[model samples]
Target: MSSYYGLPVLKEPVWKVPDVPAYLYLGGMAGASSTMALLADLTGRRHLARAGRVAAAVGATASVGALVHDLGRPARFLHMLRVFKPTSPLSVGSWILAPFSGLAGAAAASELTGLLPVPGKAAGVLAGFLAPAMTTYTAVLLADTAVPGWHEAYRELPFVFAGSAVASAGAVGLVAAPAQARPARRMAVAGSALELAASRRMEARLGLAAEAYRTGRAGAVLRVARATTAVGAGLALAAGRSRAAGVAAGACLTLGAVATRYGVFEAGRETARDPRYVVEPQRERVGAPGSEVRGEVHRSSSDGDLQ
Candidate 1:
């Protein structure tokens, strides 16, 4: 087979992966719902809070659905919870997702029938509980993989993923429930800021691997991510007055964040295929005994056998 730019072609998994991306979207939607739910309830907007709870539940359910469908054996999805391993991000994610799903489900049901006491209050508490994990654990999920860019950028990726999740959740709220757009706008700003800051920090620490962000197709993606995040965050400053602007910024941030994830993923794969990253680090690590200077060695994300 002819090579694409002479790069070694690694076969991606053969199983027909569903639109795995929807999982990411659902995650963001659930996370945003939690924030909005709590804010609305706290501010005496019971109707708004009810709406957020329903949305959170629906979004969380959808996220889980997408994740399951993406697996080669969708039925085995339940096995995610059968055991526990801290080193495995998926196992941890399953735990994080479990409470959220139960809570969101309860909250959503309460909204539909108002059949129970303290529907608004219970939902608010659940939303508050799900908010942080919804934002953060996604990073862990991807980071725990043997994937290239993901495993390497462990520290900042969680924050980046969290930031993206928060931003997207706000975007969904803007689309599905506009009345709570103010809190949504505020969250978009915070999430974008955190996302940008974390990405920048990763770019700084990853060094040559950081080139993944600054080069070729991946570079273009990173640029868009940075630009949208910056613009969206700036737009949020005065968004309280203009719902339309908030909506637009939220959408941009959401799309941009997704793009960043894909770009980083592809870039990491590219890094992995090359011999340079694989060879150099080991060379430094395999330095001669008793040399004048120490040459500490480390593995590159590519073929460092660490994946």
Candidate 2:
């Protein structure tokens, strides 16, 4: 083994890079607005729908800033749209995010006399059209990653994230109106269930890639995150079972869900930065059942301390 300052050098790359902050901001905005808008419109709460629209707009705009900031050079941001690159997942999402943000904004704005000259039915129709896809695209953005944990758990990662996004925004809705607490609970419950189902599968199905969920600072955070989201989300189902439980569930569950997202983000970055995360296990996957994993369970240089 080679050594970089007495630390054994592994064969692959460790992606300790933080997630694109823009994606973080935009993902929440897009998710919350989409769910709240759909629910509000269905419940005949035009006001909530409008609020959802505004949040989405603000969220989208903020996201663009985050995206631009993530780049080394902000001026060249337009280059993202200059080409139609299916090979690029971010490219696909940018296109989708741009238009969906517009529709959600317009739809939400229609209820405001100041934003629209004539508040009419077309806005509702357009918003309805954009809502579903808006809910789904964030998952695709994440799954598109080449990172082992992310790309390998492709089938369920999107839904797991989509559920988390809705839960966060729905928490906002719960805080906004007493009337919404019931439905908000439902959203949390469903999203939590889906998130856990996907997550468990991610951990169980991907032997090595999913190692991000089980070890290190990021992994430790992820375990707590899962517990929080699970307990919180499960309590949501019983919100009708008790008011105090409902309030506690809503607040805790929402926090837990958000924590899960952040934890995964942290873990992925850790996995990327460590060559052991990238190589050793992958090699093991190809060898026979009992083959030794080439590089995993990092034995840090300073008596096993990781960064």
What would the TM-scores of all predictions be?
0.79, 0.76
Candidate 2 local Cα displacement, residue 263, angstroms: 1.5
lDDT of 2 by residue, 1-307 (tens): 2235544333223322333534663566465666676677778875556666666666666666666666756666777778778877778767766766666666656666555634434554565566555555666666676666666677877777777767766555555444556666667777777778878877888776677778887688778878888777776676663657766776776666656766777666655656666667655665645444423333343456655
Q: Which one is best on lDDT?
A: 1
Q: Report lDDT (Cα) of residue 278, candidate 2.
A: 61
lDDT of 2 at 232: 79
Off by over 4 Å in 1: 1-18, 117-124, 175-179, 285-307
Task: Give candidate 2 misplaced runs (Cα > 4 Å).
Answer: 1-22, 25-29, 72-74, 112-128, 238-250, 285-307
Best by TM-score: 1
Candidate 2's displacement at residue 66, Å, is 1.8
Range of the 10 consecutive residues with the lowest summed lDDT in candidate 2 = 8-17
